[model samples]
Target: MNIIALKSVDLAIIALYFVAVLAIGFYLKRFATSGQDFFLAGREMTAWVAGLSFLSANLGSLELLGWAGSAYQYGILAAHWYWIGAIPAMVFLGIVMMPFYYISKTHSVPGYLQLRFGNGASGLSAITFAVMTILMSGVNMYAMAVVMKVMLGWNIHFSIWVSSLTVGIYVAAGGLYSAIFNEVLQFFLIWFGALLIPVFGLIETGGWSGMVARIQSNFPGQDFTHLWSTLGNAQDNPMGMHWTGIVFGLGAVLSMGYWTTDFLVVQRVLSAKDIRSAKMAPIIGSFFKMAVPLIVILPGVLGLAVLPEKLVPESALQAGQHSYNEVLPLMLARYMGPGLLGLGVTALVAGFMAGMAGNVSAFATVWTYDIYRPYIRRQAADAHYVSMGRWCTVIGLFISIATAYVAMGFASIMDYVQALFSFFIAPLFGTVLLGMLWKRATGPGGFWGLLAGVGSSVAMFFWVKLNPGALAIIALSDHAKPLAEDMYRALWSCLINVIVTVVVSLATQPKPLSELKGLVMGVTDIPKEQNVPLLHKPAFWAAVSIAILAILQWIFW
Candidate 1:
């Protein structure tokens, strides 16, 4: 029944991984005595630990298989999600936003909003975030199930429940501490375990240049190898997108919206030992993030150069055709054998579990601190809140399982992810950005603007769902693909949120200047990093990251 067989060595490798993670969770159980310790890892993580955990937290659905499939489907344009869409926003989070978060000592992003805006904006953001994490976890779960089914012929139900239960048990035992530790472990596993594909593929093709030539021969007249060269017009590239969409839509809006504002990744940075570690975490992560395309994008484009048959879309998959989403596993089966295959599979499994843990842990935190503590039972003891966090972890996993079934309807999990990001992250970015920069932004304005922005996004989504013709208007391009639609949708929603926030703020009474200290930029006095050497400054590393990002674009162009 299996398309690719696993040896005993493979099964043993996977079993060991499960055992190690469970051991880690039980080992850390004693540390979850207090609310802060349970949720924030005792705030003692170093820059490197926090950085790898930060990037790894996002690696699950966003990085590995989903982006690889995008590479095969859209070509070199997929790197935009890695480079311009991530690096800049990460640097900005470190140098600009981390200070506000660190200084204010807020439990979550919504917690920050409550301090600056009020219960309305805070409560809404919390609910939206809680929902987004559940959907995002489902996306990661479905992604792993898809790969397992494709490569090993495993039943999707078996894969989902097994992985979900593993994550729930560990995360329930150790809270964010357990989740962050596993994420750190997964970063190394993912890179080393999966790097074999691109290595073997490139060797078979002779090199990068050889691989490019093979792709040219295989699909003549298509531009699948350049990052920015074919981005001038929608029809010029496989992505059916333009430079404006890549730059403003993706690089500016979606990238910033997710990286700076999304608490899932931001929470990792918040676990730093000090403000310096917090500032350096994203910068350090940015350096390694630049290398991800080597594993993700290369194997995808290599699939075009090497796969025996043309892969089909998800609709045709049930008819016995390969789906683009299966490209990673397909290539995995192509190159790896025996021990290496087991490591690769285990790595993928770890990624999925860690991604789920990240989502569930973040969801539990937001639900308990933001939703329950504020609204339901406001007088709970510290032990009671920690207990609630553990219970919510199990509940979040169940919701995610249901969401995984919902994810089955979508052809590409990445599309579902991007659409979900557009719904909440784009508008959330608007509220957070204005709340941080403009001291005059009022509670009523922040609340209503966030509501309107989210409303427009949902309305446009259903409009396009009911009438596909609406996409042409919404994206402003007849040739625009789903990727382009998501980009432009985020841009639109972000602009709408900002516009409404500005208008409403001007008409409403602002929070007093004295009350805005340590929360708003103009009114706050940031602490200088006294006595820290130049080598330790976050700005120095951020500049290095930016330079590398630019060089990568130039090299790949």
Candidate 2:
């Protein structure tokens, strides 16, 4: 993976892109007048910028690294994640959840929780989100660092720190404005670089038909054409693809949680000029989601066909590990020509930086608004808050760098990272979703639900951690591994949390109708027409047709 002798053109591209990102940060300084402006870009993001920014933030380096790994192991089931988990969830969030959110006029999702539930709920949600962001950011940072180390032969810790500083400088300087602008650039780079991999792999393997032939010749009866087959099986039959798990487990739960409740995403929508833009933000991004399998997941499938047997290190095989998330990077080094490899690596870095920028901005917002302003005395002026926000960004960057170093110690960075988030997000999403949609949901119920959900999730995390096989029906089965056990524990705990929240909300007296009237009625003092334009009939129908076509393509192809 020697990348040290990068071409002058590639180095120039990387350097110029970095400079452009920093320049954008400085260019947006004029917009950083008030706390709101710094945090939400004065609610002035355009639909295109919002859409690209939302997609780029979610595309983080972990996705590029981890998804390819998942595809290598799971075949088409990996693609099912985006179709099932992300697409429908985003659609629901846009049409149903987002309208209510925009009408609420709250800056943060947790702020909306406070209005719907109570201060306790808001505080709990904020803590959960902040913790998850910190942990996940660290994981993303570590993943990017791994890429840097492998591609450039740099020290891992040095790469981690360098990445942190590069992202922090721009985000601290420009806040949401910088994050969004840079995201647009990053999105294009990521899309281009990602698409190049599979195209090149297909070309190397002769063509789509040729690749299929080679796969059949090497492993006969394998259903490589179906985007829903297992890589290996015990009974000489392809394993069931777990379409339900991809749709429900990954798509519905993970994608919906992100599109609806995650502050990183909600912040983008909040920055929209009006409600219409908010609604359109996610819809526009969903179009990009439709392409992710082609750009990210399909490369791994192609890698399985093109990569030489000895390309993967013997150490990896001896560990009983088939999925090395680094497969994409390896493929780029081995297969892609020099110039293309550089562009692909640059795209990887761009995605990493975009994610880091988003996290830094979100961290600054939470620290300055939720934690700092509320608790600290002598309320700071707009200028002072902005300064504090920058400082907080710096501090957060350091913490992420440190955590990335720690995460490198893990056996599998993506598994540890995702599992950590599920523990917090599953319960938190349940509480937030229940509080918002159910009128009977009481403030006390929200509070208690937060406590119960987090408590149960944490308890289950530890229970599975200690016993390992305690939840398994049979002793020491394949399902009893730590990662699988943790996922099951988190899933069950989330379900329990939702049930408790709903049951308690129903059993108890509802919030006063008067108190709940504002949210229930969906009334805002702002005139409805002031919002962005709704999708016209033709556009709406076209979008629906596209969605259906995407699903059909997945099914039939």
Q: Rate the local accuracy (lDDT) of all candidates.
A: 0.91, 0.70
Pick the TM-score winner: 1
Itemize residue pairs with steric clashes in candidate 2. Answer: 76-227, 85-251, 85-252
Q: Positional deviation of 71 in candidate 1, in angstroms?
A: 0.4
Cα displacement (Å) at residue 59, model 2:
0.7
Q: What's each prediction's TM-score?
A: 0.98, 0.89
Would you give me the overall lDDT of model 2? 0.70
lDDT of 2 by residue, 143-194 (tens): 8876876677768777777768878888887888888888889888887776
Deviation from native of the Cα of residue 513 in model 1, angstroms? 1.1
Candidate 1, residue 402: the lDDT equals 89
* Model 1: how far residue 150 lies from native, Å: 1.3
Model 1: residues with Cα > 4 Å off, grouped in runs:
none
